[model samples]
Structure formats: structure tokens, C-alpha cells
Target: MATAYWKGANTKTGGGFWSSGHTPTLIAAFLYFDLAFMVWVLLGPLAPAISKALALTPAEKGFMVATPTLAGALLRVVNGLLVDRIGPKRSGAISQLIVIGGLLSAYLLGVDSFGGTIALGVILGFAGASFAIALPLASRWYPPDHQGKAMGVAGMGNSGTVLASLFAPGLAKLFGWNTVLGLACIPLAIVFVIYMAMAKDAPGRPAPKSLSEYLHPLKSADAWWLMGFYSVTFGGFVGLAASLPIYFTDRFGLTPITAGYCTAACVFAGSLVRPIGGALADSIGGIKMLIGVFIVAALALAAVSIAPTVGSALAFFVVAMLALGVGNGSVFQLVPQRFGAEIGVMTGLVGMAGGIGGFYLASSLGLAKQWTGSFAPGFLIFAALALVALVSVFVVKSQWRRSWGAAEGVRI
Candidate 1:
């Protein structure tokens, strides 16, 4: 197979599918992942509405929202390895089909019973696995020099949470939650078809490694460090995305619609700005970007911990979430710099860690709210973790700079 590369003016070089530049493929991949993410996070924004109808307790509500995240986190490693073996395009399409099935099943299950909702939540997690496929797909399309931007663009699909938060509640109100869930299938179906028809695997890629080679990164200290960084960054972003609606409604006396919109706004800022964060890291340095984001995130989370009013709390939450989003992009930028060759396996592992982080944060918030009747403890705990992450990054900065051989990393 011939590799695709840019040609001189007026020249068409290669016959490979990506010879025209990767923008279209990137966009298609983004849409596919975005729809998956939207479905994966549907329960969070829909939780308040479903709970009102079901009279669910706080702990049950948290479990309902967090189950998909937990499932997704666990499934990412499986999807990542599948992508490496079958190629990203095929893996992504298959994931989307699975997501469509999950959504349809969730719709059929309805919101009548807690057990039904939990079952659906677990199934929807397959949407979360789309992360493994989309990120690697975009990364493979561009050369290593352009990976920050490519991955950033693909990652912007995480903004899909914004769409779910913004619309799912209102749609549920108008047509019922089950109908809203069923409607989600429309977008997924369309994206799945388009991706299948137009997308192609990256050309001239090497054959996948043996299972042992793929798993070897697990034994490396750097892999664990990257996992920690991702757990804080991407994990925080996802956790907040899954919990914000419940937090707003329970703590502030807001209506489900209002809470959903607020949650959507928070997700929007984080998701849309993620690419910019990657670009910034590319131009400056990933270490500097990570340090700055972590500091701001800690301060913001601390402010939320002490906020006297709902408005102040919301403001702090928004800021903290945005910083976490940027940190998500920056951490991945650094990951490739330090471990480019091991990206597939490392992505699976680190992505899993991030997913677990999200699950813990969301569940912990629920537990705190249930036991103490306040989210302050949860906020403070995450703030402390952010501070530790900040110090850890600074401590490792010199080593990363020497090993990566770039003054600064690539800006997305």
C-alpha cells in the first residue's frame, strides 16, 4: 500500500484514500465519536428527569449515571486493541453499530425500573469505547509532527456531552425519555453509514504487534505516569460531565431543564476548547500547559468547595471543568511525545485509567451528597488530587524534556 502525503501545487501524488488531506476523514471520525459520546453520557443529563419520574434515591441516581462511564472505561482497552488489529475505520464503525443497539435497547427498557436503567447504562458504555477508535484514527492520518492537532480535533467530539445535556432533557420533557433515547439512534445510524461508506484505514501501516508486545507498555513506569495524568485530566472532564446535572438539581434547587442547560454549557466550553489546548501545548510545552491547567483546576475546584451561593458554585464548576478539558488535550500531547511507538496500547491503558477516575469521582460525589448532604467534601478531595498531579508533572518535566527532544511539545 502507498502512504498518503502532501503533494506540490497542482500535483496529485498518491492513489490512497487519504491523499486529499485528512480533514474530511477527520471530520467524519469526529462526528462518529461525537455521537457515541453523546449517547454514552445521556444518562447523566437525563438522570434528574428519570429520577423525578421514578422517585430514585441519590445513590441510585448516581449509579444510574455512572454505570455507562464505568463500562466505557473498562471497554476502552478492548476497543483499542481491536482498532490496532482491524484498523480504526472498521473498529469505529463497529463501535457505532453497537452504540446504536445499546441506545435502542435503553429506549425499549424505558425508565420504569432501576434494574432496567442499569442494564441500559452498561450497554451504552460501548459508545465510550469510541474514544479508542477515533483518537487513533485521527493520529494515524497525520504525521507525528501534526498529531497534537489531529488528536485534538478528534477529541473535540467529547463536546457531544454538551449536545446531550443541552437537548436530552427538553426532548425528554416533550416526548418522554424513552423517545429521546430512541431518537438518538437516528444520528448514530446516519454516522455509521457514512463512516462505513467513506472512511478507510491509514495506508501502509505496519502489522499489529504480538499480544505480548502490545501489553509490554503496561510494565513501563512512564505508562503509569501517563495514565495518572489522563486520569486527572480526561477523567475529571468525564466525571464532571456525567455528574453536573445531578449536582445542579440536587444542590441548587434548579429544574431539570435548567440544570441540563448549565451542564451543557460547561461541557461545551471544555470540549470546544480542547483542541486549542492541544495547539497551545504544541506551541509552548505540554509540561507547562499541564502545570497551568492543574493549578487553575485545583483553585477552581477549591472555590467550588467554599462557594456560598449556587451562582458562585456554578461559576467555579465551569472554570474547573474547562481547565480539566484543556488538561485532557495537553496530557495526550505529552503521551505521544514520550511514547509514540506505544500509542495504541498506551491509549488503551491510559484511557482506561481516565475512565476509572471518572467513575470514582462521579460515584464519590454521589456518596458524599448522600451521606453528608453536601458536595464540598467531594470537591475538596478532587482539588487535593489536582494539586498532587500538578506537583508530579513539575517533578517529571525535566525528564520529559530530555527524552522527547523538543524544547516544547506541539501545539494542537
Candidate 2:
């Protein structure tokens, strides 16, 4: 059955992208991913109000937002394991329930302290871990030829962050940030129903691996390289997603709602381009797309460090986000090509790396602000990391092309 689906779905000519896979599952993945991402980064949009309410220090505000990223990064490995063992649909269902319950509980209990916010952030990590499940759930239904588009459609769920940025602040302004948490549950519950009804496990899942065997991919250097590259691209993209509101508010004295609007514009630019990035990678080669991604991201981040005006900084951020977003899609385009057999776990590992990158950037910016009285040092340092990633990808491209890239019969 799975073989027939695979062969039929490998539509290189007339069938087209939408016809190449299970559309219902793909749509379910996107919806799941979108809502999960909305709540996952919810703290970021609410950070200004939370900080003001709690009288949080700059570093505290940074850590409050960064906590979810770090926790999510770690949880992705666990979710990855679950996806392989129980299937992506089950994994996603379980994760969504946890997030909804956590948010509901937080809303009922009320978060009044910095510590309370950190706790809520940890709960939000499950939403962040949705990346591990949603991607594989959709990717497994499609063939190698359509990996980029399949993954891009599913992965585009990150656009949910834009939704949060757009609405959370305004809702908080009207009803208080704590109430915003409870209100978020309404849409989450609705999506939960839709996801349960729509999502289905793809057939022919790999036989469950032993615990030790699940970690087998780490033995290969290629896995590490992919993880490192994602940490920069996804890391930069998500890190900025969580921190931009704080940046706009602190630097420009914009109201929280206004800052969220600015953040939404930046995030929307990045989120909007992810599918294009994947498609570009599919056509040209993932390695080639990444080379350009790193260069543009690095330049934009460095430029952002010195932008003296809000308009200039927003412009730089949007450019940086666009590059990083494309890099996100390009990285995933290579993942299934190189690690198809282990896509579930690889998604977990790679997604974790991205989350850690976000954690680092979000936290470091806060520390930089507290210690140096400016966010410049943190931005410059991350910009340097992007360059390092660029050099590293360049160093490995030749060998990749000669090895797996050739074997896979896909543009790398």
C-alpha cells in the first residue's frame, strides 16, 4: 500500500505538488504547526506586558522568553523518539493536549512572578516541539521529489508566530496578559479538534528502533553539520521572532502593541518566504541556497547592530529575517534527502539545534542589554556565527556532492 502511494505520489510532471502527497494530512500538519508556533512564541509577544507587570530585569526578560526555546529544543528529541515509536499523528495529538492543558492551568492559576512566567514558558516548549512531529507527519506521505514542497507547506506553520504577534498584545492590552493566556486556549481547542479529525499517520513507518539505535545518526558527522547549520538559520529566525518585540519596545519606546506590529512585519517576511526557500533549494541545491542565506543573514544582522533609527533597524531586521527564513527551508530540503530513513529523529535533532540557537540569541541579547547597555554586541556575535556557518557549508559542499548528494539523486 505504501509503495503504491509512494510511486503514485512521485509526480515529477503532470500531478504537481498538491497531488504528490496526502493533502489532508499536509493541511493538518500546517494547522497544527501554525497554532503550536503561535503559543510556542506567545511569551515573546506578551513579554513587554509581563516584564512591566513583574518588574523584570533586562536579563530576566530575556531568559523568560529564551526558556521556552531551550526547553522546546530538548523536548524535540523526546517527541522525535515518540514520532518514530508511536507515529507523528499520535505524537502531535499528545503534544497538543499538553500545551492546551498547560496554558489553561497557567491562566487559571495566574502568573504573577518572573518564576511563574518561566514555568509557563516551559509548558509552551511542548508547542515548540510540534516541529518534530508536524514535519515528519506530512513529509512521510510524499516522495523524495516533493520533499521540499511537502516540508515547506508543513513547516510554514511557523507563520503562527505572526498571528501571536499580531493579536496577543492587543488582547493583553484590553484584558491583561494573564487573560490573554486563557483566551489563547479558545483557538487552540478549535485547532485541536481539527487536527484530530484531519491528521492521519502515513503508512509504512519504520519499525521501531531500540533506544540506543535511535541515537545512531549522531555517529555520522553529517548530522552534526546539519544541526550546526540549522542553529544559525532557524536559530536566527526564531530568536529574532521571540526578541524583536523587546528590541522595538526598548530601543524605540514603542508601545507593546506597536512593537508587536513591528515584530509581526519582520516575522511575517521570514515566514512568508520559507516555502520559496525550499522550492529554490529543490531547484538549485540546498547547499547552494544556504551559502547565499548565511551571507545575507550575516550582513543584515551586522547592519542591524548599528541602525540608529527605528525605521532603519526594522528594515535591517526584515532583510535578516528573510534570509534566515529561506535558510530554514533550505536546511530541511536537505534533511530528508540525506536522512530519509531517519527523518523523524533527524527532524527532532535539527529542530532542537534551531531552538538552542534561538535560546542563545534571545538570552544573549538580554544579557548584552543589561551588561553593555546596548544589544549591538549580541547581534554582532551572532552575525559572526552566521559567517562561520557559511564557511563551514562551503568547506563541506564538495564532499557532500561527491558522497550522499550523488547517491540521493537529488540536488543537494
Candidate 3:
């Protein structure tokens, strides 16, 4: 009965593109996420320009990009609570309003100092929290059989970074960087109206969870495993998205526009392939897919850390981002499989872990460059972490396949 309510049609897992779930909400979720993601990673491509204006150090630049990630991490959990309590519609609207106000303030006041930029990053963190709100908003509307496709379509909004890397610098070039914030508000406002009109709460949402109920999952080992794996996949994906502009500029002496172009190309590899990853995971097992993802990402990150010549670096990042993007989808495939009833809470927890991973990588890259005169150390460390996650996955695979995962109808 619950499944029938979630699946409005004869939609099956391999059905046509629009074969499953609430199409209107999925579209709204993606739009909301796409715009939210742009603002979330805004400071990354703009970091070089802002650093020039503020005279910030490498470490300062890193924090400038990382602050939003960390703030967003914390906010994801809060947004999760709000989703269960006030519902995704209200929570998303409020979060969007706060982010809109922040952008408006940045545009009108003009960020003059490093501190001001940091404050803006904090505001941008709310945009990052869109992950928690938007995923559940889309996921609850779909049946388990088609969860991957629905979530992937919504999750592809992570590609919002591509839009940021491609256009923000150009817009900044035409109008002052600060004014870019005001301009950002235009698109955000438009999405806000559209999302409000189109999106709705699903019929089969779980009861609003109490704090203890939400926290209870933390007691389980599987929860931690999902968190660790996501930290690497999503963390690495977004951290790179935010920090690549700085790396390109500092390493190759590219203009902000050029850096943005390269970043956009690499991120496009990630964004476009996410749905493919989800579909693939649906076809194969998520764990089997993730092992390969971590291996590719580890190798690619290692190559990029060398800060090779322009061509080699771009190629390496292109592969690295693609692997990480697939990993992001693969991890979510398991999330609903492992924690179906607690999907909202688990999304927040796992998503926050991913944000924290991004925060660490982004900041560490800045610090690594500052301390060693190269980004190699940070890349090496994360590569090792990826390897660790690989080993951890190997350890958990049997346990998961033998337990609750066995009951999950979709591939696990």
C-alpha cells in the first residue's frame, strides 16, 4: 500500500526517464539544489579574486573556502531536524530566504576584509544545507525500486558548482565580484518561487523523529561506515570543487576566468555522470561500485597533487571528479538500502560527514601549500584516507550483505 502511494504509475526501476516518482517535485528539487549549490561553492572560484582584493594569505584563502563547508555541515543536521518537524517545504523555504538575505547583504554592503568574506561563507553554508532538505524532499516521493534514478536526478544539482565555476568569474569580471552576489539573488529568487509552487511533502513520510530517535542510529556500526565512506566521496568531490580555482591560479598562473573554465569542465564530468552512477549502482551492487570509485579517486588525486603541467592536471582532475561523483551516488544507493525508515536522519548525518570531509580537504590543501610549498601532502593524505575507506568497505561488505541488506529489494 505504501509502495503504491509512492509509485504513482507503472514505473519500474528501468522504466523510461520520467517513469517513476513525482516528476514535479523532482524537477523542483533539482532546481532548488542547483541554485543552492552554486551559492554554496561560490567562494571557491571567487577566492582568487577576493584574495586579491583582501590581500589574504594561502591559509586565509583556504579557510575562506572551507568555512562554508564546515558551517554547512552543522546546518545539515539542523535542516534534517527541521525536515522531520516543520516539513521539507517550510524548511527549504526558510533556508532559501536566509541564503537570499545573506547574498543581498553581501552585494549591498560589499565584503571589504577577510573577516567579512568569512562571514559571507558562513551565510553560504545555509545553501550547502540544501542537501539535507532537498534529498528527502525528492526521495520520499519515490518508491524503493526507483530510488536511485529519482535521487540522482535531484542530486545532480550538485553540479551547481559547474555553473558557479563557469559564470561567477565572468560576471565578476564584468561587474565587481561583490555585485555578483546581488546578481546571484536574481536566479535564487526565481527558483524560490518555482520550488514553492511545485514541490510538496510526500504522503508516506515517517513520523517527525525525536532527537533521541535521530541520534539512535549513531549507536550502530553501519551508520559510521556510511559516514566515513561519504566523507571521502562527497567530501573529496566538493572540496576539490571549491579549492581547484586556487590550485589552478597558484600553480599555472591562469586568470580567474581561465581557472573557472577548467574547473567547470572538470566539475561537468562529475555532475553529468551522477545519474549514470546511480543507475549503474541500481544495476550492480553499491559496494562493488564504490570500491572502484575510491581506487580511481585515490590515483587521480595523487596525480593532481603533483600539480603537473596544465594539460596533465586537467586530465587528472577530470577523472578524479568523475570517480568521486559516482561514489556520491553509490553511497546514497546504500543509505536508503541500509536505513530506509530513517532516510532523512541518515541523510543529514551522512551528508554532514561529507561536508566535514570537504572542509578538511579544502582547508588542508590551503595549509599544505602554505607549509610545504606544494599541495602534494594534502592529496597524499586524502589518498591514504581513501585507501582506508576501501579497506573498511571490504570489512563491512559481507556483514551488510548478510544482514538487513538482504531484505532490501533494490541492489545493495
| Deviation in Å, model 1, residue 287 alpha carbon | 0.6
Ten-residue stretch with the least lDDT total in model 2? 1-10
Judging by TM-score against the true structure, name the best candidate. Answer: 2
Best by lDDT: 2
Worst 10 residues of 3 by lDDT: 1-10
Q: Is candidate 1 or candidate 3 better by lDDT?
A: 3
Give me the runs in candidate 3 sitting further than 4 Å from their true place: 1-17
Task: In candidate 3, list every pair of residues with a backbone clash.
Answer: none
> Order of candidates by TM-score, top first?
2, 3, 1
Ranking by lDDT: 2, 3, 1
**Candidate 1: residue 40 Cα off by (Å):** 0.8
Per-candidate TM vs. native?
0.92, 0.97, 0.96
> Roughly what TM-score does model 1 have, to 2 decimal places?
0.92
Q: Please list the C-alpha lDDT of all candidates, in the order they appear.
A: 0.80, 0.92, 0.89
